[model samples]
Target chain A: MEINHTVIDSVPILAVSGRIDATTSRDLENALNGLIEEDNNRIIVDLAGVEYISSVGLRVMLAALKKVRPKQGDLMLASLQPFVREVFEITGFTKLFLICPDQREAISKMKTG
Target chain B: MMGINREITVPARLGEIPAISDFIYEVMSACGFDAKKIMEMQLAAEEACTNISNYAYEERNGQIHITAAAEDDLHLTLEDWGTPFDPTSRIAPVTESPAEERPIGGLGIYLIKNCVDEIHYQHRDGKNILKLVKNKD
Candidate 1:
């Protein structure tokens, strides 16, 4: 997966594209780790561009959530494609993270709540 | 196994995932399988390939061989040269607990087993071979 990060009003937003399967999970783990340490632990991951995800990718996301949760911080997801959303729902991560239908709503939730 | 009915070899990397899935599904579909069957087979094949990429190779780079055949039924096999790990041997997904309470890794492999007709595993000569079959009849 290819990751690009931008700070929207000091909140780190990571835009990930391509597939996050076995080989690319580490890149995602590193990217999230960097943001969680540098920032105050709140993160918004834009998954609209990501096409596919496997269990390994799911583990990385779980690790990120586990890291940020203790700090009273969160990792939210935005705009998942159908296939990507299916994996999240199947894994029960849909309830754990704040998943919004669109990026606008996700960022808004992060800002307001 | 040199003259197997059909076989494919790919790097044990995420980049080759789609290619591997596509090839396996196409061959299965050509054997008169419906879309639902094709999808189930593809997902199972994909999960196995992903496992090999993640657990088998560790820090080292390696290759995973995928072989397919459409005799009376369709069969897909994934072979890797890395660690000796059997995904099927892992603990089953916790069916009693809710999704949030259950662990993350085993669900994919469990799903693979549920989808296919036959699930087989073996480690021979330092190669881990996994075969998933779906009967056409």
Candidate 2:
């Protein structure tokens, strides 16, 4: 997966693309870990470019969420493709984290709340 | 419109997952499976292969063979000559539990079970064979 890191209104947005499966999930894990350490755990993963995500990806996101929540920060998701969104829904990831419809809404959630 | 059969064997490693998924998608789609069904099978195949890649061989190198046969229903079988483990026996995770209370992993088989109509496991001839089928109706 390709992750483009950008700061919008100081909220870090990781625009990820391609497939996040067993092999590529480690890269995502590292990126999230680095952001958690550098950006105070306030992060938004912009998945508009991502078309597929497997359980391995979900595991990474769940781990990151657990890490950031205790620090009073949150990891939000934005603009999921239908396939990826369905994976989240089937696996119950829809409840564990805050999933926004788009980047603007995710940034808005991070900024206002 | 269903007499398609395909088989491929690749190293049981994380890097080989894409190749496996590609083969599965092509075979499943050609069998007249819908995009949604193909995606689900791909996910299930990935989960099974991931388990094989990570835990099946256990610090050793082996191969996982995948066979797809489209008859009345789309049937897929994954055979691995690795550690003998009944992956289907794992209990499903309690998804209703709060995130923090839930464990970090163990969703592999649960997701696999959800993707297909039926799953059967057998350990015979020094191979762990997992067969999954999705009806064509």
Expressed as tens digits, the lDDT of each residue in B68-122 for candidate 2 is 9996688899999998878777736655865334332257777787788999999
Error of 1 at A97 (Å): 1.7
* Per-residue alpha-carbon lDDT of candidate 1 for residues A1-113, written as tens digits (9 for 90 to 100): 68989878767888999878655788999999887777558899999898777777887888899999898888899989877786676666787789988777877888888
- The TM-scores, one per candidate, come to 0.73, 0.93
The Cα error of candidate 2 at residue B101, in Å, is 6.5
What's the TM for model 1?
0.73
Candidate achieving the largest TM-score: 2
**Chain A TM-score of each model, in the order shown?**
0.95, 0.97
lDDT of 1 at B71: 67
Interface RMSD of 1: 3.6
